[model samples]
Target: MESIGTSQIKKAIHHISESVFVGLCRKVGTSQMVAMKRDVVDILEMVEYYVKTSDYYIVMLSGSCREGFRLKESDIDSMFWPNNYRVIWDLSQSHYYNTQRQTLILCDCSDSPPGFTLLYLLSPSINRGILEACIRMKNSCYISSSKYRQKICSLSSSNETEHGPCVSGAYGTLEYDNAHCLSCDFWPPSASSWIERCHSWPQPHIVDDIVNNGCHFVAIGHKLGRHEDHEWRISFSLAEQKLVYAMNHCQFLTYCLLKLFLTEIINNGLDEDDKLLCSYHMKTVVFWVIQQNTLPHWRPLNLLGCFWVCFKLVLKWVYEGVCPNFFIPDNNMFLSKIHGYKQRQLFMRLYGLYEKGLAFLLQIPSIRSYIINVLHNPKVSICTDEHTLISEAEFDETLYNEIHCFDVLYKSDIQTCMRYLHTIEQMIGSPLLTQYQVIMLQILTASLLKDTALILRMETFTCKNKLKYRADKISCHMLKVAAKFGFITDMLFIAMYYFETRRYRDALSITEMIKGKLAQPYLMYESKVDTKMYTEAVGGQSWCTKMRKAVAWDIRLYSGIHYISELVSEQQSALRKKKTILYIPSFILLYMLEVLCYRHVDTMRVQTALDDLQTLVHYDQGQLIDLRHRDISWQILGICQQLTGNHQTALY
Candidate 1:
């Protein structure tokens, strides 16, 4: 019998993995999903009616439900915003308050201003009023306010209200038709600051988009006994919803696999009281993992790989007893649950399953047979088809359109940032510009500058000469600004810009500087999860480490460096030999850069690129990289091979 080739083995693994994911999705069942959606709509309608009749203005459905990754048992999480009152931050006192309450009560303390009040007023009377109003609603539902309050009190030993055991805010359950239920929390509009606080996140543009729209902040009770702090908990549910919505078919299916793993396997055998993990936690892990990876890393065939990445993240969190909130790092979502002995138990259970690999995943009750069939009999047809896979032409077209949009968006954002900077310069001495605002302006400006440099590098080979020259000048200035702001990723682009412009010495110098910086330990200055910040401080370091492993791994960076080094060596040899060197035109230099990039486009090179990308995809378990750039790398390699008469290999 002939032995199977390596590529065939990979293809087989890919097919089997996809089949398993499809089976899991099938087990999830469309009927249950339909039921969940109908129930959610009905609940939302009811809430909308209540808000319309009452002082509340709107009801926002949030959490897993809004994120489109909900399970059958997942509770509907929502926020109610009042219409008559405007929530405002009281600078005089370090708490939030409603503007209307200022005139209702008077305080004469020296430190406290007379026209200030606590926001929401979580007193016994207020709690009772809200609870009574819910009970009076026409919907015949079971009220679990008492049980929720008791649970909150048990979680925290803070002062309780006279009406009942109270936490930081009120909690009530509205059961509908004995088949569905919604858990609602009321919060003041001022709590939106929690979302605003994520402005310092690495992806400033995405955070800006979230802020520009609206972010919800919920009133979650204190985990510990810290009562003086009534800070509202920020929820990125809206941003998450948008992110999940933008996911391609493959990513959505991968998410389903994760939910199934959490619900059917992890939570299945455990007693109700012993279950610490939930679908929400799994979703949070997925969000962080997605932020760290690129699109190619999340292909449909790699669904199991993505699931494993999320699992490892959760396992690490369990071991550390700390699952940092995706948006707010300071808020440890797992602080209360995975403590002491429980952490050890949780870690062991997950680790054991992880060691068992596909066999363990097959143990999931609902899809056990489907997974077994896919694994044992490779010939079996897996229901999950490759419909999500895009043709080469489609992929190229999509890439072109996306890059075009990115070019326009980055240019527009850069102009806006400059205008803001100019405005700040005009207001330099004015009291209106606070320290925080100044810092924010600097951050936003730095981020936009980095983006500008990145966009310029991406377009260097494609754009016209005049535009390329303009991009070069702007990129140099932007790189200096980014350096001043201590953004290292922008510096990496600076090196690439120098290379593209034929400044080999300068490019090499910048690369060396980046390497030195990458050697140092990274520290988190702010308690927010920003992708750019993480990439610059930590992710960049990891990338450098990976690049140093093999020149073939990051062909774009390392190969360019190698070519520059060789060019410099040849020039020095000519000087030593006393030979007159002919000057090359700028266009010739650019052509040389392109040739060097595509010169080694053999079958081995193409395979090496794919293997390197796959290795990088698996490295760090679930961290995200710029996969779009990786995609471009493959395209360049293919085009180079095609030009050099390796048309068949290039087509492959």
Candidate 2:
């Protein structure tokens, strides 16, 4: 056998780079990341809109979700701060705030290390929670970081635990990490040099935007600081998000690749406590490399080359035992951890992998097959076109995940739902929102409309007479408008609303239409639907058009909203959960509704509806409902059994 020439290897590497780009495109969705970024911002705004109505704190979406990467290991990270409190660097800046309603805390960084500060109270605080967490030091009062974190966690769910500076909890499928922080309107004085260093990258406007957005102080302290219990770590999360947004798609993808490499390769088998490096370290490396103008160009063809450069920087930082923070270089990010014998062990592993060069990427499970394919066949043609990279299946899955992320269920009453409806309407009509934001707002409008309509109908009932009123007509119109923007399964809510209002005939007709639409077999249930099946079912038209015409996805029931009279009991536990979001497959919800509808309309067909529902629940064998949601499937079957007077079967 002849030895492979250097040119052939270079050609293989080029194909490998293209393959990596294509793989990432499919993972995050091609051209969909822009919409995802906008959607996350909208979610933050909407969440803050609702939260601020009841509480004084303002919430934010942070971490990789806001940065537009949806890796499996990516948890939902959020930061919240009281709007009436301010952290100021100078006492002169205290004049910027109204002491009557706002409480000011001076950021004392003199004794603390870089990137850390002790918050000294400058004025009396009206909030009892903050006052109780303060500690008197000589003539001054300093807020105890540990006490404040405990108070925040106490206000949250019991399942949450203290994880670094965040209160971490898991709900449904994802883990949520909530950090209590205080906002500083002015940029940190220590990072003033970063503004001058932005000339090479991050244009002047973006720099201004980042500086204006300022930063926050998370509830944590530097281990080496004297006032460790009282010190708070200055967070550049907001500014970092802006920097990430300014990055081109190639740069963003490169950052994501490095993250994947860290999670899937370097820390692959190491115990959670044993892993030395983290995604933040990888991100810091990328920021330094980009701002320093180390890479000539960050493009699809040079993706692997850029990744190589970043990896080498990581190795250098580890070998030298110094990884500087991008904003404040004097603060070594690797100071607390990544030292001693463990540091040498990590360097050895990284160096061994570095010796393998680009081929070391084969250890990553997500893109391993792609790398192997290109290496085996150097002449293989790999299409890098954005349009070609997206398959119908991937598109559907992406849309499904995006749609379901709107699953936050709150305990709202009639007044709250009406207010939410009004806010959504105003947002939808605004000219400032992007097209993607409008689409998300419209989706939210569907749910709010349904909730408000049901609440109105529920109010029109009386003991003397259950007579129809104008509320019924208003509800009908609102539900129809909701159906216009909602998924195909959302149409069931109309049937559900009608059934709840004792309109059996109307409910039956809507269920019949839904049944006909779902019969197409292209309906998505989790990741069960495939491209081949979709193409065979609706191949002639574009996938976008087909999806628009056929949008029968899964069904979700939010607590605090009147969805189904029969399932109210089932939704209580969901309401008690942290996020209060509940999910039910479309097939299960539809069949259960159909059976209940026939119980009042046609007694002869009741048995048939019940039998079909039972088959779906027990005999479908995970075809319609994914394994993760199988519990809800069984519960629906039990409900149908009890409704049909088969109490014994229901108990079984």
Candidate 3:
């Protein structure tokens, strides 16, 4: 019944934030954060390198994913631009252009807002879309931003809608916003002052990097600009990502906390039209606060204090009706909105919450339980006993998630596999790559090596020269390397390849060895692996070490790569839409391949293999063959039955 003081709540919030927010909750730890940042850059660079920027435009991932925050509600943000067009500040800078290859566009800033420009076509382009987007204005050709946005959106499906500069659409279960932009390597004069202001915060090296990356001209213009329909906004998104990467762990968490507060508390019950603050405005506020050095130290214990400072600044900016852009201070981010009655209402609402002080955080579901715990048992709540163990466990969870995210990020193809190998080679000697990233690289390399071997095997059937022997030898060596580096079940891919190539004896030998290994009961499974059993199986080694040699739970076959001839047509169709993956349990794939191999090499053992496969398909009860993949398991069984002339059973 006694009242809790403001400082006590602050202390409790800090402890809770350190425990809940920093590890598994929305906040990613320092190592995971570094890995996330590196992973995005590497993937984007790989896209550029492998695609040659010919089929798809060069892309840079923006937003929270690039900033290393893993909020569940976060949408994917990407900016892509064709490699053929180059945007320059003036005609004097056209010397770098190759007239045969590049179409030059000039940035016109005369009639636009501070952070926006009109793109003028300085040279003819072969792309009919670009030609159509250009309109003759004042005897000069300028690209119409509205027309360009329409052109970009037309390429997407009918369901995609325009959201500001981005073309928003859903890719499978995830929603994404892809902004079409033109890259400008030259830094804009409007933001020249930003370079000078970076002296205190973003070290000199970071400033150089940002300047080198320059800026992009996104499709949207200022609402009140003179040529609003033709204008494009100057985007410093790449630079902002770099600034985020430079922030300390505590500072980064404070930013994440601000985003959390915006979504969960500020916009909790408000309708879409009534909400004024967005994640962008919060990001701008944090950038200003950091550059100004308003907080001396951003330690974990003072995390609540940091969030409070940022919240008050937001309230002040709302009251003032001026939210300045970090790169261009003159460009009032809230110029058209956040004025008059709405401004007054938002400030009063925030001010009322401000009066509640740190207790306002109680509205957040993730932090509420901690606040209750602290209030009930103040002395014991902040104690270090159980929190340390919890932190360690969450740390392991973080490691596990980071390691597996590679499979989620990309599917295997010859180009992607080659690019991944190239990226891994570049990252191997780099100091910035973390140990977890290295582990991830090894796993991906192993998987992709299998893909490379399978593709080479497909190509071998067409060979008529000495190169065929070389390709065959190299393919065999790569599979050996893949098995050495990948999970225990990855060897099944090699067996599958041998079975396909009519090397039945070799394929059966691999299936026999794997069956023996899998019988030990220590192999991992999809999200269902028992940690204690796996550690015991691996001789009490750490998770990091065990993951390197972990037994494979499933045989993962990506759609784009030519894994099996029977599945080629289905895979080709699936590749055109999205990355399709088939998860066949290791035992099921082994048994299926074993049945096929036995039919080719020894007719006598065929029935035994068929009996084993049939038992797994019908009676395993989701033990060896997971029910999630039951359809595929049955399909495999049907294929085996039909192949061996059991027509009636295959139909059933």
Output the number of the lDDT-best candidate: 2
How well does candidate 1 score on lDDT at residue 236?
54
Q: Which residue pairs in candidate 1 collide?
A: 201-530, 202-530, 202-531, 202-532, 292-623, 292-624, 293-624
**Candidate 3 lDDT by residue in tens digits, 1-652:** 1356866665676676555444323344454545544664555455345545465468777887777766777888988888888899988878977878888999888888889889999878777778888888979999999999989888877768999899997754678899999988888889989998986899999999899878998888898898888899999999988888888767777787788788898898888788799999888888888889989887766777888889999998998998999999989988887899989988999999999988888887756676566567656444323234334334444555545554443544556667667766776676866565566667667766777777776657687768777888888899989888766677788887777767889988999988887766555554445566665667546554555455455666777566666556546654565547766777778888878888888889888988898888889876677767787778778888988999999999
Error of 1 at 535 (Å): 52
Give stretches of model 3 more than 4 Å off: 1-27, 30-56, 96-101, 157-161, 268-275, 340-345, 381-397, 407-427, 430-433, 465-467, 515-522, 536-545, 551-556, 576-588, 598-652
Going through the candidates in order, what is the number of backbone clashes in each? 7, 0, 0
lDDT of 3: 0.75
Per-residue lDDT for 1-652 in model 1, tens only?
Answer: 2356867766776776767666655543232332333333433333234425443345555555555443555554554544433222323432334443321111111221111111232222233323342222123221233333343345442332322121332212321110011111222233344455543232666655655554433333334523213223334566666565555556666677777778888888688679889766877787677766633476658877777777888888998888866655555778767798888988998999979875687666656776567667878765554334322222222222222111211123344445444543554455655332333334345545665565555546488989877877887898787556533333554655566567755765665565565434331111113334434543423222322221111111211112243244444543454422312222122323334333343334434334333344335222223333333334444554555566886798
Candidate 2: worst 10 consecutive residues by lDDT?
A: 541-550
Global lDDT of each candidate: 0.47, 0.81, 0.75
The model with the greater lDDT, 1 or 3, is 3
